[model samples]
Target: MKKSSQPSLLNNSEQKAALPCDHIPIRPGNFVADRIFLAKGSMTTPERVRFVERICALYPEAQLVECPDTPHNRIDLREQDNLARHQKGKHTLVFGEHKSAVRFSAEEGNACPNYWHFSPYGFCFYGCKYCYLAGTPSYWHSPAVRIFLNLEEILERIERVANQANMPTAFYLGKLQDGLALDPLTGFSGVQVPFFAQHKFARQVILTKTGQVEQLLKLDHNQHTILSWSLNPPELSERFEENVPTIAERLEAMKQCAEHGYPVRAIIMPLIPVKGWEKIYGGFVERLLESVPIQRLTLGGICIYQNAKALMEMKLGKGNNISQSLDPRSKIGDGRIRYAQPLRLEMYGHIVRTARKLRPDLELALCLEETKAWKELGIEDRMGHCNCLL
Candidate 1:
């Protein structure tokens, strides 16, 4: 079967095109492209042109494929052999997949929740050292922000689904990109929140590591949207996270969201092991209890994709030697790697116990784990969809 070559598309009713500026320089193996769509507020034409021009100059190897002004016929660009090169440690490309409203599930899974992930932007701007996306096919350059203008149609489908389902259905917003990071530029939440707010059966969750909560706070959040934040200890943030918000800032944002009566969840995932991690993580848990009234907390240990194991090992280098020493083996599908099950159980057990003591009513769960682990912890009853239910 021939692979479908549909480029991801978006509604761009608000976008305007600028004249081609100077040619941006690119090294031998880098592929880059940019398009200017109608930005929400105060985005001048010259500024947009300059931003595109600057990026082209920075990545000269990239091809500036211009997208159409009309909703249809937008260019669908693909990386020819650059992905293979990224496999080799050479040049990187910023590949864009312009998806339409009905076609949004890009991950590898048949059981993908029938949720619309309107990824306007292709890659994340924040450079977390342990970012899973970075290890995937997209991390050829400093993550670029690609916005899908056709969000209106995506929301329309969500509404249509909500009308059919009498019971509540949850949809995630930040799966492909930081849900709120691009809100300042796109104002997606302004449109999305109001749309979902009208549907009694629909609940929207926007997750992010960025602390740009002001954009979301401007809207009326009447328990329609749940603003979630991914969290880690200061030690992990400082050592592993790059170009992201501080833990204090994120927690403060959570406090603000909770105060506004919006249900908020915290995800302490990709839990990396380091020296004195127990002590540091314990303190971090204490700080979280003191900071906000968390609606739910999800725990996850490190699960590396097969392709990223080498890159991750190189990135961690000497810092992760301790983790390498206590290697534990487990398999998920055909993928397998080392994450000591005993150690994972021990670490997660501590977190679950501590969090339960801190907030007895706070819902707690794990991200992606086997059912046996839940049974081992004696919390099988709490496991549900995505293991975020309690």
Candidate 2:
């Protein structure tokens, strides 16, 4: 599909488009979950009960369990990271409530603008081989995917934060989770998109790998929502990304969103330096620029927490390219393991130049690198435009 400079259809109305979801996403992105668990007090309110019932109906075949005393984040077993176990647990879905969902970023040292973010969904079902969430505190104990039932309260918190700010503020949805991975089942986008469209100052930004955008094409976004995808070249994705959509498939979805009048953006992130990387990456960047009408393009390399790195090595072997490439000298500013400064500079510079040479007008930014690195790469002034930022 070719991209148009202007949106083919205006989405600021209730009019729906006859769009197809040709993209396959996540790990069984259209998940028929193995089991569904109702957490403690998950059915307290009528609204909460109704939402649970709606999701449960979608997976009538899934086993349903009632957890009377356990929170959704906690489980009785330690979910092992073996390939077999990792894929198995990803299908486990839990229903719970997070009373407070809005939080500010703490990435002060890593050159981040400290954006405000929220997650109606907890954990991810897409089991990437190098998933950083695997090592985070929330997912370490239990890696099962969850849907937060207190969405109304979460939206209220977001509006409260937006009110505190004098101008338009963005509340990110994919910081802790792939924003739309489970949207087909939860229908969260149908709720959040309209909320942001009708609100005065709140803008929604969703980062995702899912291509089930039928709900988005039908919504009245009013140009208030920004959809970004975590993209990698198909070659590298095959090595790292498991059970996620291909680069071409994501670009197709981006084209549809652009045609339907939604602001689109992408991140070529966690760039792995495979053999003949220059040619492969250069070609990929050219295709990306020529394929989608993206407002911004962000680039980043792998930044793995120690625990996450350990788990990654388990899947890719101790001598994997990613693990071997880590700068043994020391960790970077964010205290995450990364390639040597020079190697990162080389990779970032190559991709940046490739993107700029094709679409110099395209907005650019770096994700999760030190301030000095950005300055050296000559894009320090454009730091805040990265994925999930305003």
**Which tens-of-lDDT digit does each residue in 205-228 have in candidate 1?**
777876666656766766878877
**Which residue window of length 10 is worst by lDDT in model 2?**
16-25
True lDDT of residue 137, candidate 1: 50
Instruction: Give the per-residue lDDT digits (tens) of candidate 2, residues 1-390.
Output: 322232212243442221112222232354658788898657887766766776677677888888858888875444454445556568888888876578998885588788899978888888688898878877776777888877766777776677667468898988888898887776667768877887677899999987778778988999899999888888888889877777677888899999999999998878887778889888888988898989998888788888788888878898887888888664766688888888888988888899889888888888888888889988888877788877
Query: How far is 264's C-alpha from truth in model 2 (Å)?
Result: 0.8
Residue 112 CA error for candidate 2 (Å)? 1.2
CA error at residue 24 for candidate 1, angstroms: 27
**How displaced is residue 154 in candidate 2, in Å?**
0.4
**What is each predicted model's overall lDDT from 0 to 1?**
0.58, 0.78
Candidate number achieving the greatest lDDT relative to the actual structure: 2
Stretches of candidate 2 exceeding 4 Å from the true structure:
1-30, 78-85
